[model samples]
Target chain A: MSQLKLNTEGMKPIYVQIAEWLETEILSASIKSDEKIYSQYQLAEMFNINPATAAKGLNILADEKILYKKRGLGMFVSPKAKESIQEKRKNQILKNLVLELVTEAGRLGVDENELISMIKTSNKFVGGRDHERN
Target chain B: MNVIESRGLTKTYGNLKAVNNLSFDIEENKVTGLIGRNGAGKTTLLKLIAGFLHKTSGEIEVFSDNPFNSIKVSSNMIFIDDKMSFPASLHLVDILEAAGNFYDNWDAGLANGLIDYFNLNPRQPHSSLSKGMKSAFNMIIGLSARCPLTIYDEPTTGMDVAVRKDFYRALLKDYLQNPRTIIISSHLLNEVEHVLEDILLLREGQKCMHMPVEELKELAICLKGKAGIIQELATGKEIYHKENIGKDSAYVVVKNDFTEDRLQNVKLSGVEITPVATDELCVFLTSRNKGGIDDVFDRN
Candidate 1:
């Protein structure tokens, strides 16, 4: 759980980074659906950030319906939290990275066919590696 | 609700105005960083709020009463600085006991725990401690006081890196338990930015920008690309800092008001955009000129 070392130098704000990190934890199944999540105070202490900032991060997830509050108990991950997070990341994170890859390829005089082949090779290599580990 | 409010607060030191017509409100239960360069009237403004100095003109209110020499304000507020000194005759532990009697919300247990944690020798007098130890002691008091309005002006002056880190964590943890209006004045925003909810930036005794810390991170963005493209794109936009990267490339910081599509287009045009860090953005905003120190070097 100590993997929350934030990139203070990155272009993304800390709260957004926190929200993304929690989504990542959920996606990785470290936190399961209907399970209690870290409170704002806990996040603040863990990250050495302002409680308000941590609260803001939690509120973002809550607003997205990935988390729901249970009165005084605290926030719990939604049952569909993983699916929603996956959908959001597909539309946002994966798309942005792909866009960057394509743009860089275009700048380097990489044709669409060559770019597609490179992506296919990379995907196969990564998939085979993961399968081997499994 | 606003825990502190100043209307055109002005404090003049004979021919010089240390605080000039500053008007801002600090909401309760929020940590605000009073950030500025040296001689930027940060201390003067904090003093005015702490009721140690009187303003030449204008008005400042703490808890709806004038803060100047007000008994009500003094009891409810704690101001910690490097210059804070306890009675010469009192031992460190004795001073803690006295403080316990003074503030209604004093947490003796927390104070003792922090004392043991820092390994502070309570038997020694305040003056006998090292600079770093003295600062740690002052911070201990500042935190244990649990005042409604806590003002810390560079409370980490002599602290080492580890001590500073622990101090910030302790401050944040305590604040979570007992929310209050805390103003931490520091020139180094990078160190304190994450700990702050809001930032009240000052420049030359005037308010520069006051906003949430998150919004300030997105206030401007740095763009690096071909000189022609960057210059053309920056036209009619508010440029905070600009410089020639090499011969054909230029780097410019401009207001981040671009739509997603425009930003995408800028990327397509080969312009790299990076978010301006809080400290760097403050430097750009408070810089006297767009050229900065390079202006002095580039007299061609």
Candidate 2:
């Protein structure tokens, strides 16, 4: 959707960035379940990246069972894509992010209870809103 | 399979070896970047593949046949660069029409569309266009030809940044519809890095690194942190670049893939990890007197 702005300067690999970008779109329901996803060719055109590199991104999602191929019809989001994506991100990314926050909080003398309370209170303000800005 | 392959290929001029004993393959349907510093024999290699230059020794093959003045190879390939010449009497459209006679895969509609997109005037003489306009026109021809093997050696020589972006966007768009083997040799690595499937690094005419851009990114990453900690952490890693940032702080480019498991406490403490863009990587790898990048790769 041209919403994904890649950070070429960052340490993150490009394929991983592409996968994460598509994942965010999937999680937001902007790209729905059972819907045909962008082919590697389309992704290559859209992002000005190599088609092979784009295919690798698609492959990453396929490996995670987030996207599945349909023979000649191209890749489609799995029916349980959103759930799997949500669960995976929560366990993998969000957990790591929260852990980092807690580590920083601990370093700053903000104890466990204070950090937990802060998160709980902050959740209310950010409730019903996607944390990632489109 | 490789669309183009060379084994111990050597091209010399007088006493100087323009291209040393080089060996590499150009994989089919992939956009490969052929990059090197000045006088690194990039143009010579392209010419050899194009049948414009004869190799002094070793083997070179295109589509399993020698490309030296072969009609089969010439018909299937398109080569464009800054030095590309056109008949002074021919108009832009006239030249394209003539090109159509040669390249069977030529798409006239695509050429016309590119003409419109690049704002190239068909009525104008090819020689009359400015430096940037000529490059754009050349790019249009290269993209529209849709040959099995297309080589553009510094195609964006005089084109501006916006024009270069347009060229890449157009190339990718067209390439999606019709897959082909494309070799783009450019000094502007930052612009072409993402679009390239693989990179072929050449130094003093020898094949250096022929790696996927993604893997190369992982292999060579810059680490910024305190000098002491940076040095301690860089014990066994291949250091690409090391520089003093300030009085006690330094930045080092280590050939670490920056895997998740590789990220340790020292990283969270101070060391800021960043990716080395293809441009910097090329400079570091090709810069003389610091030992070659190929030599430093202990893993390979």
Candidate 3:
């Protein structure tokens, strides 16, 4: 029941929150590829949101081919769901975070060279396990 | 079919038009929130649907037929108001038995389960229970009735915050198990907003806004920055509220979302953009000092 957490005060809409949560689940392999993910009803129960909102969230994944629906059954993860989700997140979410970091750094008078070295130093800490897992 | 439909619905009491020329169709199998300030006609509209009050002029259709005193509509709907009265002589058990006979879709098992969950003693009379207890009992009946078009007007009137959360959890659980058209009119927007599929906002007897809750959030945004900078940014934008937070910084809600290009100014101007909750939007939309609709039409 407590597998996924939500912030009611978060700025993102509920549907977007649901979608991102599903992505995290997929990436973490908690929901294996081609396995049955939550039905709208199950999601509605879990999040205490409208089933339609939950459906909208599922639809986002379906639209992106990360999830596929079966007739008379629930949605299933696409075989390449994790890769696709990671690719999309890296392109969009991670990019946004980096942009904000760079912008904040500039505001604080930190130069590009300093920021790059900081990123490099941070990257080395996760060196072997991250690449091996990927 | 639309679960409930109102076309040019007008209900007036003497000089006051409680509901003015309102037209909206509530779709089946969706939870819609009917919200307004006190005396803004939420109860009047629900009462009209529940067959307790007839509209002064115009139409209200429930399940494709006129609802005023119609047995058909009454059979399919249960209107739960917090202070709903039961015969004082009849005990809670008797009322529960009577409720089972009234609604066709009633689930006795769910009724029993909810009774236990809320820790109610069925032997106690309705009049003897405290306000919070009364509300909890009302909720048990409403949830167990399983009516197709169920309406709850301020169902959490006297319940504490913990009990309110439990009620919402039970509501979502039941709703997931059995889909129905549910309408709740409550002042606790922050607690209830997540459960709502759409919001039908009323102000001074007129339908001010009707849209999905997500869209409502997108339609307005809160901006914070230097007083002069915010003032400049607010020009040509629909400003909901503006106030100086300190000597230099100010908080402003404008009718727009800030973009990178939009907030790019915030960076140079030392301004910050932040989240605005729906409750704030609702307050600004309904406040008297805001001049609401009057301001829109007052060109001078």
Candidate 1: regions farther than 4 A off: A1-3, A70-73
lDDT of 1 by residue, B192-276 (tens): 8888999999999999999999999988999999999999989999989888977999999999999988998898888899988
Give all TM-scores, in the order shown.
0.96, 0.91, 0.92
Predicted candidate 2 versus true structure: per-residue lDDT over B1-300, tens digit per residue:
999999999999998898999989888898899999898889999999988899999999999989998988988999999888999999998999999888888899999988997888999999999999999999989988899999999999999999998898788778878989999998778888888889999888887799898888877777788889889878888887777766999888888745674675655675787778778888888888665554678547
Highest-scoring model, lDDT: 1
Best by DockQ: 1
Q: Is candidate 2 or candidate 3 better by TM-score?
A: 3
Please give, for residues B1-300, the per-residue lDDT of candidate 3 as tens digits.
699899999999999999999999999988999888898889998999898997899888999989987889989999999768899999988999999988888899999888888888889888999999899999999999999989999999999898998898888888988989999998778889888889999998889899988788677878887888788889988888877776988888898756756665575556776768898788888887855565688778
Model 2 CA lDDT for position B50: 88
| Local accuracy of candidate 2 as per-residue lDDT tens digits, A25-126 | 898889998999999877876777888998999999999999999999999999999998889988988877876787788779998888889988888768
Note the residue pairs that clash in candidate 2.
none
Residue B231 in model 1: lDDT: 92
Which docking class does model 1 fall in? Answer: medium
Q: Which regions in candidate 3 have their CA more than 4 angstroms from the true location?
A: A128-134, B257-269, B291-300
